[model samples]
Target chain A: MSSITWQTVQAEALRRIRTREWPPGSRIPDEAVLAAELGCARATVNRALRELAEAGLLERRRKAGTRVPLNPVRKATFEVPIIRQDIEGRGLVPGYRLLTRAVEPAPAALLASLPAGSLPPGAQLLRLRALHLAGDAPFCLEERWVNPLTAPGILVADLDGISANEWLVQNTSFTGGDIAFGATNADAETAAALDCPPGASLFVIDRMTRAGEALITSVRLSYAPGYQMQAVI
Target chain B: MSSITWQTVQAEALRRIRTREWPPGSRIPDEAVLAAELGCARATVNRALRELAEAGLLERRRKAGTRVPLNPVRKATFEVPIIRQDIEGRGLVPGYRLLTRAVEPAPAALLASLPAGSLPPGAQLLRLRALHLAGDAPFCLEERWVNPLTAPGILVADLDGISANEWLVQNTSFTGGDIAFGATNADAETAAALDCPPGASLFVIDRMTRAGEALITSVRLSYAPGYQMQAVI
Candidate 1:
């Protein structure tokens, strides 16, 4: 009993679910009963059950007790890694080449995608276009717009050496962000940059990070053909 | 003090992080100190800090206290919902049409994806092709292969009214699964089924589910042009 932990209880509960000893749609024992049976504190049992419910293996409703859901919609989590690290993780030499760097007013579409009041009226943003390489081959094309008001350090930062993706991650303190995954056919410019045929299907990730009320940056990465993002549930 | 909860402690910790009071690269106070200051149990403070560490806002090292990360690699979680529920959640009418159904030996590539010993030698799989629609417009094309050994009930189940995606959720109790997102150029058959032009960019999701050692199903869903999956950190 002294050696019992929440993880131990969670493993036992999961084993029961996997073996169908506690079958689907059947209510699991209450927290107090499970605590007594497993020789652990009630809080330990509660924590174990709560985690399983969060993972969609168990269902808990107000005043209805807990049960295994008949149709559980599981969740998959992905760690959004830096592009350079992603390439290096695959045992490839990572390279970056800056193609364009300019300061301009953000487009209306980009502004609409961000949170309201992210930037002052008529504020100029730093725009960067770069290509990431894996083992001397084009990997991904990055198009980014950074709010100078939030990340003013970019004004004098050297773009040739460090990518904005890595720079902001190290310097910025973001409170929250949103991400989206989609597919797009490469236009002529993107195709030329990625060294792929025109209209090739490309996996795309769009992300916007924020610090309190200020928008840190908005960036889009278009991967070369056959790029896949994997996750587990 | 008696009314203090872990949620209360967690909210305070999040506020400190958001406001930069606990700046990046600085170790936070010990759990005992935080508990004493907040008039809560030590376990409650420990739980709150553990969650923040899991969310990538803080870095925790064994024997070294927790500290906010300078370059935090945040995580984004996406709920893998059933296709019908996905359409309905968008305020659209859901529709399904079965395209093909056959029992055949699993393909070599699919067999390689699952865990070892998922199927015995020469086991036949149930292959299904279907189109999911939203508001009379093509939304996605589903290609699924189900191992009959694990899900024998699927063979006798009427799939016309209910998709394998939904049927499996209702009947199967999976222990774990893997998912991947990618992009592909729509082939002729897929283009026709999705009512899009050939070579159109498509968002694709590939998934495999297992119950203990038995593989239940392997599915690939090709979404129509302009479909985007959203997530949050």
Candidate 2:
């Protein structure tokens, strides 16, 4: 019996693509042929190719066979890490300071960003403003509106020692979320927090997380100047 | 005989997580128990759970068993699509115009972005600047440098009608690449191309693609004001 796994088959196929042995726009061998050559099951080869096609690395037609894509629109995965971990990843000390915490009525814009019917009408939200520091330098300013009903623990959680960003990640069980990346001109208040010149361009991330039908939090994280988020494809 | 597949097992596991039947920070049932209950092979259950663990939705410890993550740092996948398709996806007419094409010595910064030893010293690169339009309005400005040696066909490719962004996608086969997203203060030239005021904050994407060890292209895309890149987790 062949003890080869699908991952081994996948690595071998990727090697051929990288080496240009199987050039772009050219059809690769049939699954049965590859299985015979690699001493694996045809099912194993099928599994490997299916994953590669899903990743946009290969193009598979119903009857035309599988070929390397000429222009592959690859999917890049970005992990949304906690701010403290982000700072620590850069070999800097992570510090958090809570700037403000208040319970206020949800704003119309905030309500529009959340899922419809996720929050009750006129529900009050716990708003938090905090600054994350990397080695005594301003790293990011976090402005968050948390649904107290969905995460009741936040109303009583300690905001001085830890950030709402970390606290919610530890307590909430979000089923799904949407995130947006864009650029914003830092206003005077934002510039003061980030310690950048007014009107400087800043990278911003806006996210809304939910647990089932219940909204958990809506947050905007504005990073200091020169912050770049990276990914691989 | 059971007809359960790994996908079916995975869906059931995900449903449990979404419903909070297996609450956060709690260990899920063992593989043997789940297989018996779900009437599937033990290997199927193992495969299903393994995928969830890899996705950061679950935490698996060898001796302690698997538990739902209390603080799941979920990953979001963004697809890098051709600029024309991106415009059309918004239900707008797509237009492209090539502004300039020149062959110039590769700059030190561009060479440093690529993998070391990917380019020979003093090699000339094909530089192309173009504008993408949505319904006759400025959308994005693309500044690209193509390694002529790696993509020789681009030297004579008809870039007037079709953009290098689209043309290269249809011709090049890159194995891996890196992308960075940030904010840039648009200069006078960039602002003119994007139809935005100078010093306005613009979202920028910088990418470097390679085929094995051979660098294929280095490109930067600057999106007009109010542009946002979105993803789901």
Quote model 2's TM-score: 0.91
Instruction: Put down candidate 1 lDDT per residue, B172-223, tens digits, no spaces.
Output: 6687788999999999999999999999999999998887888999999999
lDDT of 2 by residue, B29-63 (tens): 99999999999889899989998997888999998
Interface RMSD of 2: 2.1
- Each prediction's RMSD over C-alphas, in Å, is 2.1, 2.8
Classified by CAPRI criteria, candidate 2 counts as medium
- Could you tell me the lDDT of residue A68 within candidate 1? 84
Per-prediction DockQ comes to 0.74, 0.65
What is the alpha-carbon RMSD of candidate 1 to the true structure? 2.1
Candidate 1's DockQ: 0.74
Q: Can you tell me the DockQ of model 2?
A: 0.65
Cα lDDT listed for each candidate: 0.90, 0.89
Q: Tell me the tens digit of each residue's lDDT in model 1 across A1-233.
A: 39999999999999888777888889989999999999989999999999989988899987899998776778788888888888998899999999999999989999887777998888899999999999989999999999878886888888898889888876666777889999999999999999999999999999899888889999999999999998988
Name the 10 consecutive residues with the lowest summed lDDT in model 1 chain B: B168-177
Clash pairs for candidate 1: none
Q: Provide fnat values for all models in the order shown.
A: 0.88, 0.82
* lDDT, model 1: 0.90
Highest DockQ scorer:
1
